[model samples]
Target: MTSRTLPRLLQTPAVLLLLVWMLVPLGMTLFFSFIRYVLNSLRRPEWTSPSIDNWRGWGNYEYVLYSAKDFWFAVQNSLFIVGSVIALTVGLGLAIAVLVNRNFMGRGIARVMLISPFFVMPAVNAVLWINMILDPVLGLNGLAVEGINAIVASLQTMPIFGGFFSLWPEIEPVSFRATQTSAMAVIIMVTWQWTPFAVLIFMTSLQSEDQQQKEAAILDGANAWSQFRNLTLPHLARPIAIVVMIQAIFHLSLYAEIEIVSRGNGNKNLPYLIGEFASNNIGAASATGIMAVVLANIVAIFLLRIIGKSLMD
Candidate 1:
């Protein structure tokens, strides 16, 4: 066989599989979106079956856009969560990567511990953090607050400083399971899990730093901060973009952490919103799913442009 033909033959299975995987479900979703389909409908039994006779003609999209109360909220929340996580992971990852960049005792162990969080299942991370670490009455938050108060109480019995100590306010452990705080908890857990990923990526990038240039900078009286600001940061620009986009993709679809943390009490991202609508309103869910596709594509395009520009060099 010709070399070109051989390559095409070898790629056929993957190309066919990918086409099927992409088209089948998405085609079905499109078909469903244009029809009045539902799991159970007592008032209009015709709506229970998917058929061309019940064509919606953008009715579903309109209903999701205008009628659904949670659609905008979910979009905003999704962007907010993804944005916040990217900001934090990038910042913390840079600092931690710098901290562990130099040789130190037990640096390998520290790196292992830092990276271990990334491997934990999202469900387990949420459960462990919400119930064991952040629980108001049962977790370490409560115990630490109680301990602080006890210390303050003991200090209050001291001679001259007793009055000052007595005036100190008691500490209250934050209950992270409530509506607003539950979202915060989800954010915190997700950040912890993903920051390690940022660290690993940045650290790998750091290993490619120009050491001779760094040495020259030091010789030229460039301080650590100046060196980092001038050289290290510019070197890290591409990797930072890569990390941001990857994290954005992962966090935009965040579901298990949100589900396990607070079950979308007050913090439903787009995916969670789609899941909720899918329970009772398949048409709305499909419309929202299409919106999600568009949102993800926008991000993907922007990221791919950055990556492609860098690749050209």
Candidate 2:
């Protein structure tokens, strides 16, 4: 056999195995999506089992699209949370990465501390943020607001500043668990956790940047902002694209954080919607899962195009 032919033959088993591993679940999900499958059904016993007799055609998809009120909201919320997290992480990561790139005292320790947040488990991160930091009554958020109000109250007792302090209204701590703010809570915690990931990628890319080019720019009377805007940003384009793509894929299906933060109160994403459907209606859950796969693919394709363009440029 030729050398390349031999290697291809050897790799065939692994390639086939991987394909089967991915395709099997996808096939099952597709099958379930087209049928009336559920865990328990007293009205229709046959619907509980997965069989051809329970065929639903596109009924489940129709139900999800037209009947289910949360499907569209979940889709919108999922995209919102993912987009917000990506924006925050990328911006903060770029700023922190650039700041830490400079030589300074305790640089090594600072790098370690900055990257440490990425190691926190997603569930744990959510719990900590929602309970310890963002809680309206018990968390640091409430304490800080309370402290500011207290200081204002004390100032209102003073002679000259009393009138000014009286004009200031009492500040109420925000309830992050509320329907309006639950999604923001998710975004904030997720951004905190994932920013370190972006930092790591950007920092590694920045280390490989051409120092001579930077020195030349400095000698040419370019300010720090000019060097960053022209030189550093261009050099880091590929890394930024990579960070965006990977984070988009990950945050698209966020579940643990959503569950811990809101329990589907007002911040339900597609995955959480699937979970809610799965508790009883397997067919609807499977249908949602299929749609989620499609959504993820569309996002990945869009981001891939951006990556490809960055590579070409």
Candidate 3:
């Protein structure tokens, strides 16, 4: 065999395996999506089976798009959480990475500590932040808020500042359990966990920066802020693009963190919404699954375009 033929032969099994892995479930989802199917029904139990007679055409998609209010909300919340986390992670990560990249005592240990959060499992991270840190009644959030209130109340009882303190209302701890703020809670935990990843990437990228250019800029009497904006920021453009793409792809399908923090308690992303539909209405769920795939493809294409442009520079 030719050299290229041997490589192709070696890769054939792996390629075929991956094709089966992806296409099988995708085919099933597509088929089920176009037919009427549900987990439970007393009338016309045949509706539960997967057959051409139950063909629904675009009815499942129509139900999801038109009848379901949560679908739009889930889409909105998903984008919101993803965007927030990306902004937080990239901003905080760049700052931390720049600080940690400097030469300082115990810098090695500091780097280790900074990156430890990224190594933690997502579920564990979610639970730790939600239960140990954010729980309104028992966690630091409640305790800190309660302590402030007590201090305010005590001040109100004092003669000198009693009137002034009485005018100030007591502060309330923000609750992460409610639907309105659950997505926010998810965003916080995910950011905390993923920021370290961004830091590590940026730190590696920073090491390769042109120190000679920085020295020249210094000789030119460029201020630190100017140097950073004109030189450092441009050098980091590609790394920033890569970090954004990876984080966006990962965050778009976020599930464990959301489930642990919110449990879809009125807050849901596409994945959680899909799970909800899958519990009974398999057809709708399948249709949602297909739509999710399409959405993911759209996002992936956008990211590729951005990353490609960055790399070309």
Candidate 4:
């Protein structure tokens, strides 16, 4: 036997085990998606179990796509939250990475502090943000707005500026838990937690950047913006792609933050919707799970193309 044949034989068991590990659950999900499976069905007890006699075919898919009122909204909200979080994290990450790349006092402490948010558990992060930072009455948000309004009130009593200050309307603290703004709260808290991940990735990439090129650009009288645009940005292309791809995959499946922030009130993503379905209707939940898998694959493929192009460049 050839040397390569021995290696392949040794690797066979692991490859088969990995395949079984992935494919079994996937196969089960697919099977249940096509059958009328439920956790509790008193009216039709047979529907509670998985049986070929209770085949649903495309029924569950149709139910989710048309019968479920929130399916479309959940899809849209999922995309929106993912898109918003990715954009904010990338922008803020790049900014912070660049700022901290410079030599400054307490640089080590600053880096540690910046990355601390990422280590916080998702549920705890959401709780801290909603209660301590974003709460409408007791949080810093309320205090800051109240302070501004108080200052405006004090200024209105001044004779010369009384008329001008009166023109300033009292600012109300925004209720982030409300239906209209709950999604924004999810986006905000998620961005806060995940931006550090992007920062870490970009900061590492920046360190590997060729300083000789930067010095050359400086000698050529290139301004900060010019150096960033021409030299730094290109160097970070692959890293940015890596960040975006990973964040897209993760944020698409966000559940804990959504659950805690609003209990899936107006911020239901695909995963949250699946949980709602799984409470009773396993078939619908499985269907949703399959659809989520599809959506994730589509995004992964699209991002893979972009990452490939970046690597090629």
Using lDDT as the yardstick, the better of models 1 and 4 is 4
| lDDT assessment of candidate 2 | 0.92
Please list the Cα RMSD from the true structure of every candidate, rounded to 1 decimal place: 1.6, 2.5, 2.1, 2.7
State the weakest 10-residue window (summed lDDT) of model 2.
304-313
Q: State the lDDT of candidate 2 residue by residue for 92-176, as single tens digits.
A: 9999999888899999998888888889999999999999999988999999999999999999999997998899999899999
State the lDDT of candidate 1 residue by residue for 1-313, as single tens digits.
7779988999999999999999999888888887788777899888887789989989998998888888988888888888888888999999999999989999999999999999999989999999999998889988999999999999999999999999999989999988778778888998999999989998999999999999999999999999999999999998998898878887889999888876846778899988988897788888889889888888899899998887868
For residue 292, what is the lDDT in candidate 2? Answer: 98
Q: Give the C-alpha miss distance for residue 127 in model 1, angstroms.
A: 0.8
Best by TM-score: 1
Arrange candidates, best lDDT first. Answer: 4, 2, 3, 1
- Tell how far residue 238 is off in model 1, in angstroms: 0.4
Number of the top candidate by lDDT?
4
**lDDT winner between candidates 3 and 4:** 4
Which clashing pairs does model 4 show?
none
TM-score-better candidate, 3 vs 4: 3
Q: What lDDT tens digits, residue by residue, belong to model 4 across residues 47-107? A: 9889999998999999999999889999999999989999999999999999999999999
When 1 and 3 are scored with TM-score, the better candidate is 1
- For the record, the alpha-carbon RMSD of candidate 2 to the native fold, in angstroms, is 2.5
The runs of at least 3 residues in candidate 2 whose Cα sits more than 4 Å from the true structure, single-residue gaps closed, are 1-17, 302-313
Clashes of 3: 0
- Tens digit per residue, CA lDDT, model 3, 140-216: 99999999999999999999879999999988899999987888899888888889999999899999999999999
Task: Quote the positional error of residue 76 for candidate 3 in Å.
Answer: 0.3
CA shift of 161, model 1, Å: 1.5
- Worst lDDT run of 10 residues, candidate 1, spans 260-269
